[model samples]
Target chain A: MSERSPKKTDTMTEAERDAYHAEKMKKKKAARDKILATKTEERGLVIVHTGRGKGKSTAAFGMVFRAIGHGFNVGIVQFVKGKWGTGERDVLEKFPEQVTIRAMGEGFTWDTQDRQRDLAAARSAWDAAKAMIADETYKLVLLDELNICLRYDYLPLDEVVETLRNKPRDTHVIVTGRNAKDELIEIADLVTEMTEIKHPFRAGVKAQAGIEF
Target chain B: MSERSPKKTDTMTEAERDAYHAEKMKKKKAARDKILATKTEERGLVIVHTGRGKGKSTAAFGMVFRAIGHGFNVGIVQFVKGKWGTGERDVLEKFPEQVTIRAMGEGFTWDTQDRQRDLAAARSAWDAAKAMIADETYKLVLLDELNICLRYDYLPLDEVVETLRNKPRDTHVIVTGRNAKDELIEIADLVTEMTEIKHPFRAGVKAQAGIEF
Candidate 1:
């Protein structure tokens, strides 16, 4: 059997072919627009502020303000701190129902050193945070000062990633701490590196309240 | 009909009372000692370098370098940047397996007007980060520039808290950002707020490479 020559018998009128081409182009354009729209829409995000440069938490806080302005609920879980002077807490208290806050209860390691107790506190905080992840209530969750937990082996890095992965699709997480983990970067959609070439502290200036506290 | 009330018994010996008091004091002392030990010995901590001040991310990077010195894996994630123009990424590249770095695709809002696309990119980075949180392979996970996502409503906050709460008990997480939520302050084992008292940018000094990028 003669190999069926590629059938090429369709010789349409110019008008008909032009119409067909136009229709195809329209469909392609529509598809492209849809894809672009999808790509541009906000979904979920992970952010990191690191390096020697300052304003990491300030950036995070700015984002918090931004989210709140947009009417999203916020939650915060701080690890590695117990009781101390707090101005942020006072500000957050204004919107009590919209935000939930919890402390890790360890304070500064320099002051407290009960390993078992500290571990227990971290565990409890973890439990509360886990529940929040499972629930689809809040829009944002901030994990503050978590780096120290890993450095001291208070919590494992593997488990944290798993939980983050499994969180609701709309949830956004922001973590602030020195010494961020490599695994976090691999999975993060965005990462920023803050470098400090100079700091007031290096210039023999002390931390100033209301501005540097 | 000894109707009234039962008679009180106070027959403890002087020695017994002394023993009881001594024991109580001992317990109190033990508790205090335990707390001190945990503070210094447990020493689970993450530093927050934030404010209008400088050296926020630089401090974080210092921790990263220190952790690597101890033969640990590290992860770096940035929230508000679109490029890898700094040496941070270059250094991370040196240990490809040990370090992972990601950038926030939209850079800062000042530089880009495509909030929609920026949000989308932030979301993808967040999705990737979630996976890392769960993987349990990396010892450290650094979330960079996550604050912007929260501020812009690119990601929800409550969910972020949940992930931090549920992360592996052993895994360590570092969060960097500015204006961290008060809720985060409450739960953080350590909470440090960086306030910008003065900045070069405020004086119209443009961000310099190796310093502000």
Candidate 2:
């Protein structure tokens, strides 16, 4: 029997635990290697971050930042944020050669007031996005809040899906916003829903500069 | 009946849709402004990211990137990731004056297998975190994977909670890991559970360099 029951690990002697742990790791490594062997195909990923919580766009930008770390050319198309001077935008804009950001939305639909204008902005952003996707130099493209525009039916679903389906083999695309559609989820390789458990906003706390933006 | 149904927006004439949308936005803005009026108090927050999903640490680092955008001083204590040379670490470390990162933990429990050593590492990381919290210069502190230590009882829950409770009034602290304790969530001003809807690893996709790291 194994003496390294995680809960009772501290109770065991160091020598006893180390030997047991080492053997366990050996088995784990073997099993992992087998899995890795089967994972031979390597290509870009279609990632989605959604749900009614924070970090949907933030997490996508995190990936963009990581891509920047690797010296990868990146593109960001903000479908609804509309050049709001967000903190992420300020930092990312510093790397102009490595990153190109288009904040196309006037604001949320309510702020825009004109359905025609909102639709125009969405189309403009989508056009920018398609161009970026077609460019082989860009390794990663972030479609920030594209899901919101899709949720509101600003762009045709088929065109967007078709573009993603035909994206370059080595290009990675991340879509962020709440309420991702069924078709998008169906094609995504990874999806994370940031669920709000508690928010300071409900407790009468206003949004802060760096933390919220 | 109103003519600006979101799904039917493109079908309506520009004049008709603008009038309807404008009226709707006016009422919405009034209601929103009322809520904004009540949210007058401003202070730093205790934020927690936990769940069995991805993006807990990724989202936390995203905030770090945003903070860097504003030139806010940040301290990152990575309890379990160790010095794996993660992409976020490489990028954030570029701004040495603005950010200090400590990748303390050796590895996951299974990888280390030394219970005593893991305990020692956790204590060391916690000590560093406490020092960061006490230093008034740090505007934001990210306790990366601290919840995993707490979940495994490596560090006393009460001490962690107390330190966070007494953190500087304007110093925001973000704790990230899956299975966050209820006590931690209870005191947190903002809590988000990253729910995993889908993952590439499940489909035999290996972790990509910049995207996963």
Candidate 3:
């Protein structure tokens, strides 16, 4: 345990404040060092981005760019959102060798209004995703909106879980969408559910080009 | 509404699949044009990121980079986390002119274990945040981990809410943390909750440098 520093006030002199901050940071460093010493394992992860809130897919796209920053090859399979022209897709597509994207869905279920067609698209997307998972060449694969497919039973949950369970040891996979199945959550190494606390749509604010898409 | 395209099989000729995809995309373009026509209003937003999951702060950081891509100046105030060396901080700090960051907290409540000190830190951070909010030069201001400060009652909720409610019309504000207050959510333009579905820490996997921090 680290010792707590004395309270700081706005009236403190600059030198005094700096000295206090330095002392506090030293204690924090010691505590952090103790924790870091025990954590040494590194491996690929099965990450899930789910919930009824925005940014599940957006966050996954952010990770794609982060992974690219580290010079990792990436693959993206869109299971529900296929109609919109996203800025991320345009930017990522420019890196042909490092990125492979397959937008397989016609649209969301409500927009398409065709169960059989939605199922077909999901199956096709799943096929593409499985191939990416098996390939060690791609370090990260983002299965965008795959949870919608599973929630609607467009694809078998058991099979999807089994495939993810058998993914390459060093391949990270991120699945995004709302209503994620329990099985997928159970198998995922990291899962984030986006809760809808407040929404601009309710306030009559339309989604913007760069912000939303 | 657009009609659903007929299902295509893997056996379809390359040219046939291409033609089908092109036709579908054309219909999608028309539908999208209709929606885009109605979305003419543009203004600043009060966005909230809350939930018991990873990526709440990560997603907010992503937006900072995205805003930078559009040539917008960004200000970041870390209310609870200030001790760790985050990769984003290092990168964003390089662009000193475009990005201004003030990591104000000594640490989290559990780490600091001092209520009066925490309250003092929160007040100081809030003052800095209010200054950023009033500055017209910053297009986006991210109050990182602000929810934690509010959750602990370190600052007055009414004052924070009123300030955000009266923010500049064209300046966006993003507040990230878990256990967001209901009053803040009520006034927010967009709210996202990151639910913890799975966490690698629970599985004994250590947080990575670029990934977690």
Candidate 4:
């Protein structure tokens, strides 16, 4: 065997190690204080839900219910899907002022033959979303099916990111849809991937009310 | 001459109503067909970053980044904190897979404090959150605070919703922090709550890291 030289290890000196440890300790203390101080200040929560998997909107609705239970005002703006046999419309409509709902009735891209109308509706929705973000009237804001708009070129991704980045310090925003872009993910504090493994559709089933709808 | 009550207008018969509706056709037939044919098809989205908030889980990171660029996953789950201090954390320690991050931490509650440990430790993080709710293996789940043990009597309210509720049909889960509960919001699909709100403490502030330890 060709004589392989012994591997070398980089070791820190005592002084270097001590300094490093001290720095780490400092960071730890800072973090602890931050956690302690966080109890008093108000901040924003941003959510982005997207993927080929099912139940994205359903998940959002669950959070909405939880937030409401905790006494929070919520706002939902449906980007591409407006009218259909959706259970969300039925249930949310019945809620008190604790929740506000808005939708773009143009439906999906292929349905809205007029490109201008789709773009205009998206712009209008964006304007409303901007207002909500600025006003802080609602504790939570849900942008339902918004990712589709970004993917379909209905709304500029840049503007969406900019708005979210500068949104009110206390209002929470949730963006949901498939084909989420990378730019939006960069600015976000958390990210998740929903990879489709198995689906009931492959077995030939139908969308049912109160479950799939 | 007195004001008369308004007369009832003519009402449409069943046949008339059917006729009126018969003329109105759905605009996007093919898309509707596609949507109708697949029972388990994914259409829409939701972000659930339900996990421990402090000690740097960054539940919303992956989702926010994905929305900013093309080809990114989107989701979030802030399980614990209901308050602030994540802004700086969001600015740092970003991962490509994270899209959106939202955390809710309000420090530790004392009355129910453990006699064994005074400060929080990462190793014991999972203990506080209700298992099914804080499990972050989903596309998004951010158990923010959750450190109350049954002995502490900090967790309660209702049965855990379960991972099936808010979790994406396909994704990873993100569980953070201490005492997970029974009524843990298990069917969460996504779930999170602040465990340390209104924590008893002195007025002057100084957060130490590693051990408050």
Output the number of the TM-score-best candidate: 2
lDDT of 1 by residue, A1-213 (tens): 122234222465645654554555467667655654544334455556555455556556545544554556787788757421243554455567777888876632535545556667878887778877677777778777665665455677778878887778777777776677776655555455555534333333344322233
Cand. 4 TM to true fold: 0.46
Over B112-202, each residue of candidate 1 has an lDDT whose tens digit, in order, gives 4454566577787787777777777666677765665765556877787677777765455666667665544433444444434333332
User: lDDT per prediction?
Assistant: 0.57, 0.83, 0.76, 0.48
Candidate 3 lDDT tens digits, A15-89: 676566556656876887787777777878889988777888777766766666566789899886643344555
Q: How well is each residue in B63-93 modelled by candidate 3, as lDDT tens digits?
A: 7766665667898898876522444555565
Please provide, for model 2 over B71-97, each residue's C-alpha lDDT reduced to its tens digit, 9 standing for 90 to 100.
899999988854234567667767899
Rank by lDDT, highest first: 2, 3, 1, 4
In Å, residue A149's CA in model 2 sits off its true spot by 1.0
TM-score of chain A, all candidates: 0.76, 0.88, 0.88, 0.76
List, residue by residue over B1-213, the lDDT tens digit for candidate 4. 223335222265645543443333244556577776665544222222232222223323222222223223433434333332333233222433434443323333332223223223322433333343344442333344332322132332322233324444444343334444433433232333322211113323233211011
Instruction: Give the TM-score comparing model 2 with the true structure, all chains together.
Output: 0.90
Global lDDT of model 1 = 0.57
- Which candidate leads the pack in lDDT? 2
> What is the C-alpha lDDT profile of model 2 across A63-156, one tens digit per residue?
8888888888998888876423467877887789999887784745555567777888889889999999999899999998889888767799
- Over the full model, what C-alpha lDDT does candidate 3 score relative to the true structure? 0.76
The regions of model 3 sitting more than 4 angstroms off are A1-41, A82-85, A90-98, A105-110, A113-120, B1-41, B65-71, B80-100, B105-128, B151-159
Off by over 4 Å in 1: A1-38, A82-85, B1-213
DockQ of 3: 0.20
